[model samples]
Target: MKGRSRSTGLLLVISGASFWGVGGTVAQKLFQEFGISVDWLVTARLLTAGVLLLAVQFLLKDRSQVIGVWKNKRAAIMLLIFGLAGMLAVQYTYMASIHHGNAAVATLLQYLAPAMIIIYLVLRKQSVFSRQDFVTVSLALAGCFFLLTNGSVSQLSVPAPAIVWGVLSGVALAFYTLYAIPLLKEYDSLVVVGWAMVIGGSALSFIHPPWQMDFGSLSAEAYLYLVFVIIFGTMLAFWFYIESLQTLSPTETSLLSSLEPLAAVFTTVIWLNEPFGIYQWAGTACIFGMILLLALNKKKPAKSNDSVENEEPLRVS
Candidate 1:
């Protein structure tokens, strides 16, 4: 039973990561081949996925968490900030990265969030600097530089705007990772993430309403891709990752999720025929190396910050 549980956890993590990677790829396809607007897609994804997840939580999990969260004005306010600023910003920046570049680059770029989180923790006095942290930061910086510049300052291999958006996505993801911990401990993952989606989506709706987009103009295939993004990418991916937490430690879960970017790179290069040079591959290796570096660090007694009650923010990627 122990072996079976471990295997199940591994499978769940792999599936979750793969779905996220493929979902990003499909999103890129919609943007590049189908002319789908990022605004419409992001809005619809957040709103629809949020409603679906909350409905599931209400039916299958804790119903009270649905309303209980809002009963506390303080917790509700933090949730609101997480939803509107963290969720909305991360989603928008991530999609924008894929829009400017390929899924591979965007996903790898977002992996920098781990390093950013480390720095934030240190600055906030939540965590102290370690040798491992120094190594992680070095690899991340070198990897990003090589991936973007390819060892020369003469020209950029990737678009400048894509890099900006990708870095922003990492920053936003760091915020999501750190801020959602308290909420996740207090409420179901679905409650926190679901409401966050609704809040963020609603805010963006005012900027670019989902109804404003020409849905009819898109091909049936495009609609299918969009559905995949909402269901498989956003909802199911998160579900599998959360389920894995039942058996795996947070560190193990995070290390395994490095597969997300690897899957993205493979799909983007092979399926999408995107150009990824040797420098990019090296950069990918560095990012993955950092993941391993963190995961292999000596484990300590779980704390609110390290514990995964229902979800790890890594799932959000």
Candidate 2:
């Protein structure tokens, strides 16, 4: 049973990552088709996703749980941060990074959050620095270099500002992933995510008022893509992510999720006819190899072996 649960959790994490990858690509495509700016897309996505999430939560949440969060102002505040920083900040920085740099470079640097997660875990004394961890980080970094440079070290240079913003986005992502874990202990993951979306989306909506949104201007395809982003990208992906956090360490989950970039690369190749150089292929190989190593090298606590469970904030602006 334990093994089955672990397997299911692994599957869920992978699926979540896959959803994120596809969602990103699809969102990019929507931008191309709809002639919408990233700012508008980001605004629309968060608004729609937040409303849908809150609707589901309100209909499905237990009365007792609702009362608990209502009274626990501390948890409510923390969750608001979770939405603002964890969700909105990361997404916003990702867009900023791309505008400041090339999309490929932005994407590569943004994923540096995995390394940040490992560092934070080590600092918190959450886990010892296993050789496997080091190897995974090294391999992942190598992959990023290859992916961005197309395997040529000569072409690897990114704009300094872009690199800085991308790394900062990564840092924000790490904190968001870390700080929110504790809140999951007290609230249902769905309710927590729902509330975070509502709060965070509200905060971001003020940046671009929904009153300005032109619903009549949207094409059928664009609207369909929006629904896809809200449902699969924001909702289900986060649900699986929080569920995986119950059984996986921050490092474990982050490393496993490194597959997301690889998924993106493949999508680009298939959809955009992007060519992969030898170095890019090598880096991709290393990233996947390292992920497998981390998965197999994980240590289960002897006392807590039967426990399937247990479940941040830094401003990244």
Candidate 3:
């Protein structure tokens, strides 16, 4: 039974991560082939997924948590900050990255969040700069260099705006991961994330109202893709990942989650026919190695807040 449970957990995590990766590719298709705006897609995805998640919480968990989170003044403030600055920022930046570049590059760039988190912790004196940390950071930087420049310092493989958005996506992702730890520890992950999504989506709605899109122009197939992004990519992906934690260790789950980038790379290359050079593949390998090192490290970083090892953030594409 134990073996069966572990296998199930592995499958759930892999499926969840793959959904997120492929979702990004579908999003790319929407942006390039169907002319969907990033703001519109982000707003629609957050609002729809957020509501659905809350509905699940209302049905299965404590219904009060759906609203109880806002009763506390401090939690409310933090939620607002997380929603606007962290969730909204991450979503917008990621979609913008996909809009400016392909999904493969965008997803790979966002995976740099782990390295950024290490740097942030070290600079704050929360963690020591061990040899492992050194290698991790070095590998991330080298990987990023190769990915962007394709082994040359002067030339870039992708556009300038894409690089900027991709890097910003990583920064936003780091903030999203770190900032959500407190909220996650306090309330259920679903409650915190769901509310954050709604808040973020609500704010973005003012900027780019979901109703503002041209509904008539969309084909049934395009609508199906959009539904896939919101349902499979955002909602189910998060749910599956969190569920897998019930049977697997956080380390195992985190390591398995590496399949996200692999899925993105494969789908982007095979389905979209995005050109990837030899240097780019090497860069991808370096990033994967860095992720593996971080996941395998047993020592938890000493910090004022809860350790990151206890909870992995929802990696919504």
Candidate 4:
């Protein structure tokens, strides 16, 4: 039974990561091929997914915690910050990256958050490096350089705006991973993430209303794609990931979640017919290697709570 459970968890985490990857491709199509805008999609996605996940949390998970965090003033403020700055920023910057570049590059760049987190910890004097940490940092930087510039230091093949957005996406993801820690410790991951979505959506809705999208211009397929982004991409992906964490450790889960970017690259190249070069492939391998190294050389990471305790709150949608 334990073997079967572990196998099931491996499958779930892989599928969840894969779904997130494919969903990004679908979103790219919505941006590149269709006239749909990122702001509109984000507003819709967060609001819809937020409501759905909150529904799940209330129905299947804890109900009181939904309202529980609000009773405390500091926690409530922190939740708002996490939602607006962390969740909304991460989602918006990521989609903007995809809007400017392909999903493959954007997803790969977002995966750089592990590197950013390491840098942040080092800056805060919270961590000291081992040989693997040095390797992880080197691989991450080299992977990013190759991925973005294809080994050219002076020139960038991808647009500069795209690269900027991608890097910002990574930074925002780091913030999300860090900011959600206290909230996750206090409440269920689902509860914190659900409300974060709602708060993020509500905040973005003020800037760009969800109801403002042109529904008439959208095809049935486009609508279906939107539904997939909201349901499968945002909601089920996170749900499956969090569920998988029940069986797998954070190190294992994080390593396996590298499948997210690989899946994005494959889907973007095969399904969307986006061009991917050999250098990009090597870069992807390097990034994946960093994750593998972390998992293998587990040294009680500086902030295990972000990954182990929270488990699945950091899904970059």
Candidate 5:
């Protein structure tokens, strides 16, 4: 049963990431046809996800766990921060990166989250890096900087604000990944997602009022895609992401999910007819090699060090 459950969990995680990987394609399509603002889309996604998640929790008799987090001030505060910093801030900045730069650039830059995770752990003194860790981090960093560079050093001209937003998104994603582990132990995945969505949605709704939405302007296709983003992209993906957190450590999950950018790049090339460049593929290969290195060299703590606790929260979206 344990093995089956784990296999099931791993499957869920991969499927969820895959769903999210396709979301950008769907989103790009919607942007072309419906003229929807990314801010509004983000707001709508958070609200719709929160409602559906809460509905599922109640229907599944998961309210006790939901109420438990509500009663704990520390957990409640953490959820709020997770909603703000992880969900709202990260998505907002990422969308801004896409808005200011090309989605390809934005997508490639965000996967730097894994390297940021390693840096954060090192800063916390929780990381004991082997040569493998150094190699992975070095390769990931080189790939990121190479993608950020435009033509030549003298010709580097990407918008400073876009670069700032992309880097901030990566940092937020890294922190979110690290924090997700311990939170997984404290609450059911859905419960945590529900609360985070509620807070995140509520926060966004305040920034972009619902009254501003033009309901009558939407077409059937737009609504369909919108529903897809909310249901599959937000709700379903978040559940599996959180479930993956249950079994995979932060570094493992972050490294694996780095494939999200690779998926995005390929999907863009095929769906959007975006021209692929050799430099981009080379950078992607380097990132992939880094991820493989991390996966293969994952170290187990010493046999005598069984008491080392995993106190970090599990972050999935």
Candidate 6:
């Protein structure tokens, strides 16, 4: 029974990560082929996914917690900041990276969030730099160098704007992961993430309404892709990852989650025919190695009451 449970967890995490990875590629296709704007897609995805997630929470979990979060002034303020600064920023920057470059590079770049989080903790004096930390940071920097330069420092393989957006996506993701800890501890992860998405989507709607898109320009296939992005990519991806945590250890789940970037690279290169250099592949390997190192490190610094293991939120974008 235990073995079967572990197998199910492995399948669930793999499926969830793959959904997120493939979702990015599909969003790239919409941007490149269908001329979809980042703002519109971000707005639509957040709003639609946010609503659907909240509905799930209402049905399966504590319904009061959905609106209950807004009742607390401090929680409400944090939620707003998380929604706009963390959620909206991460979503927009990631989509913009995809728009400017391909999904493979953008996905790998965003995975740098773990490195950024480590740096932040050290700077904040919350954690001391250990040998593992040094190795993780070095791997991340080396991966980034190879990824952007593809062995040539004089020129970049990806556009400057894409690189910038991708880095910002990583920063936003770090903020998103760190900031959500308190909320996750107080309320359910679903309630916190769902509300954050709604708040972010609601705020963004004023800038770029989801209804502003040219419906006539989108074909049936394009619409199907869009729906997949929101439903499978955003909602089910998060749902499956969170569910798997019930059976799998956080370390195992994090290691398996590396499949997200792998899936993105595979689909972007094979399905989208995006060019990936040998050095870029090396860079991807470095990042994957860093993730593995972090996950396997058993002597990690102790966190506060809001340890990441309490609620390991999956990256929705």
| Tens-digit per-residue lDDT, 73-97, candidate 4 | 9999999999999989999999999
* Model 6 TM-score on a 0 to 1 scale: 0.96
The estimated TM-scores of all candidates read: 0.93, 0.76, 0.97, 0.94, 0.83, 0.96
C-alpha positional error of residue 204 in candidate 2 after TM-score superposition, expressed in Å: 1.5
At residue 58, what lDDT does model 1 achieve?
Answer: 95
- Model 4 residue runs over 4 Å out of place are 1-3, 301-313
lDDT of 3: 0.90
- Which 10-residue window of candidate 5 scores lowest in summed lDDT? 301-310
lDDT of 6 by residue, 170-224 (tens): 9999999989888877898778888888988999999999889889978998999
Candidates ranked by TM-score:
3, 6, 4, 1, 5, 2
Top-TM-score structure, candidate number? 3
Q: Write the per-residue lDDT of candidate 1 for residues 136-214, one digit (tens) a residue.
A: 9999998898888876779888998889999999999888887887887688888999999999999999989988977
lDDT score, candidate 4: 0.84
Q: Which stretches of candidate 2 lie over 4 Å from their true place?
A: 1-16, 61-63, 97-110, 123-127, 157-165, 240-259, 299-317
Model 5 clashing residue pairs (backbone):
179-313, 180-313, 180-314, 180-315, 181-313, 181-314, 182-312, 182-313, 183-313
| Model 4: residue 180 alpha-carbon error in angstroms | 1.2
Minimal lDDT window, size 10, model 1: 300-309
- The candidate with the higher TM-score, 3 or 6, is 3
Q: Model 1 scores what on Cα lDDT?
A: 0.85
